[model samples]
Target: MTNRIVDHPVLGKLTNRPPVTFTFDGKTYEGMEGDTIASALLANGIRQLRVHEGTGTPRAIYCNIGHCFECRVTVNDAKIVRACMTPIQNEMVIESGKMQPAPFKASPEEWPRTYAEFEKMNDNHKEGVPHA
Candidate 1:
């Protein structure tokens, strides 16, 4: 009942890789040794990896290509890694991000943009809008 395709018309058959055991949200699950955490979760029909930081709505893999940070999850209670980019490993503790009551607040420390730099950036976008 997995969504994973074992055989493809172009790639023929995908060899069965060694089984890897891991836990997601405290529930044990099995995945192929080389599968990414996101793929493993999707194969097992466990979507909704985490909630949106701005809105408490549930979110799954949006771009799967690692460009988007929508699939971020905590690993081993310490590191926050993108599930779509992180490979599955044995006994890895994966936890979904907890829901936030309010939207994430951006700070100068995180962005590090000076007021002058911000003004210059804003000025560049002025041409795109019609003036009153």
Candidate 2:
């Protein structure tokens, strides 16, 4: 994928800064010097950067303008940075968190198991019948 955000709707093509190469989790990626880490990552097809700190759930960019805290990543020695607003710099170390594996409970076959268990003990109604 092209690492240049030339046709983006909001930022459009960045023509001022020169292109620079950097590594994200050992993968080499290229972006303009002025482009934000999140923008460059999206252009490079990297959607999920890390998992939530406590929940271990996958997280990625939610707001490209830094309003949301979804795109937080560790850069250099810094932690909890909004990647959407942080510009790229030479020799910057970006440590992206690993994606969480899909939970087994979310599988299609597991739905029946969960539904059956819910149906057995659900007694909220006066009739003691579980609602589907």
Candidate 3:
């Protein structure tokens, strides 16, 4: 698809630069050097990147920034990375669906299975160290 950012309301004619091509789920798309992965996908008319793990529903960018995890996608074998924050690189492979088996499994290093556990851990922490 055409990577040229013609005329956007707020962005307003994205600056022309060296074009780079990459694939999203096997479809080629062109984007500028400075565009984030999300921006490039949006420019190429790709809204939904992956399906939700539990619900299997379509999901895409939510906050447009890294604050929300809705835009998570597998990049070059790395899972759960924020797509909006990642810049497109040459030959990068972006895949849909939550990475199977999870990169982190049954590991205390990946704590807080639920938000409540995260909150509890946060409450017990002092100087960024959890109470032992």
Candidate 4:
């Protein structure tokens, strides 16, 4: 659980900023200021941010930059965003899950029961809209 880089050989003690608290999957963790969500999660010992939307395989941060699109996460129920580029903010609520599916119309009975329930749970929260 010790994810902080405490005494690096070259940089010495790395964490220098005040701590900020955020929630991941409903659990709170402390992260240093100036940390990207990905870095903060890693520092807090969290690897899996989500599952593959198509395959259901566990996924973590792949590229620390904004190009790879592998570090997508829902921030503050606002929209899916890249965790590597988004800086950590105190009291932020992050959710990990498959990417939102494409829009489609289906009968209430035709919708998958679990998906419907999940939608219900998220209804109070505004979905994060991806930027164009």
Candidate 5:
């Protein structure tokens, strides 16, 4: 995937600054200065930031904000951080994996069909469609 935003209608030429190198899941990529980890990763063509710990589902950036912890990643072998809110530093090491606790846990018997649908709507948002 291409590692730069080109021809954006509102944010034309999104990457104009010098490149900074960072590693994600053992792969090196370049990002512009001041780019958030999520933005840089997406710009670098990485779609999924983590997997659901229980179901092993692919998870990408949702809100692009701190409210949703879906973009969490292990940074520099330190604590897990919200990728959408954290700026990428030169030579930063990033590892992709589930970082937050499950939203809720329940046995299959306890989760009814309607509850499953509700959870799906919640994951994709209540708008009846998941964001691409």
Candidate 6:
């Protein structure tokens, strides 16, 4: 069964658009029109989208909005985009970004102890951001 909400008291019945066929990671799946790629994947019971870069842990959609980029995926064998924000299209090829694992050497003590330190660390780590 699909994990979609077909009806609701507040919203009444859902009139979904026509189903769109697409491929994710070489596997075909059917999603309804006006559905975001992330929502479609979740409806189809796909929880995990990709792996974490540093620890190699699994990652999935978080926050459901475009704010959190945890649901990023490559679209049409080209640009990487936030799945939660991108609409699904027919025959569209979506591939999860398989971030390679990297060694995390820092222990709890070595890690930042405060939010300010964490911000500092992140600011330094991110590239192309103008230093102020």
Q: Using lDDT, give the best candidate's number.
A: 6
RMSD of 1: 10.7
Model 3 lDDT on a 0 to 1 scale: 0.78
The C-alpha TM-scores of every prediction are 0.72, 0.62, 0.66, 0.69, 0.68, 0.72
Q: Write the per-residue lDDT of candidate 6 for residues 1-132, one digit (tens) a residue.
A: 279888988989999679999999999999999999998998899988877765668989998888988988889877558999999999999998786743334675667878898777777787797877
Q: What Cα-based lDDT does every candidate model obtain?
A: 0.83, 0.74, 0.78, 0.82, 0.82, 0.84
The weakest ten consecutive residues by lDDT in model 1 span 103-112
User: Higher lDDT: candidate 2 or 4?
Assistant: 4
* Full candidate order by lDDT, most accurate first: 6, 1, 5, 4, 3, 2
Better of 4 and 6 by TM-score: 6
Give per-residue CA lDDT, model 5, range 18-82, as digits (tens): 78899998989988899899989988789899997778899989998699898888999875599
Candidate 3 lDDT score at position 95: 79
Q: Which ten residues in a row have the lowest lDDT in candidate 6?
A: 101-110
lDDT of 5: 0.82
- Checking candidate 5 for backbone clashes, the offending pairs are none
Query: Which prediction has more favorable TM-score, 1 or 4?
Result: 1
Error of 2 at 2 (Å): 2.3
> What digit string (tens of lDDT, one per residue) describes model 4 on residues 1-132?
377777999978875798899999989999889989998999888999888885678888887888887788899887669999999999989988675464435555555568776576455344574435
Which lDDT tens digits does candidate 3 get at residues 1-132? Answer: 455457889979756778778888877778778878888888788889778775577899999869978988888889887889999887788877653444333366657889897776667664666568
Candidate 3 all-Cα RMSD:
9.9
Candidate 4 segments exceeding 4 Å error: 99-132
Report how far off residue 68 is in candidate 6 (Å): 1.4
Q: Can you give the lDDT of residue 107 in candidate 1? A: 54
Candidate 1 global CA lDDT score: 0.83
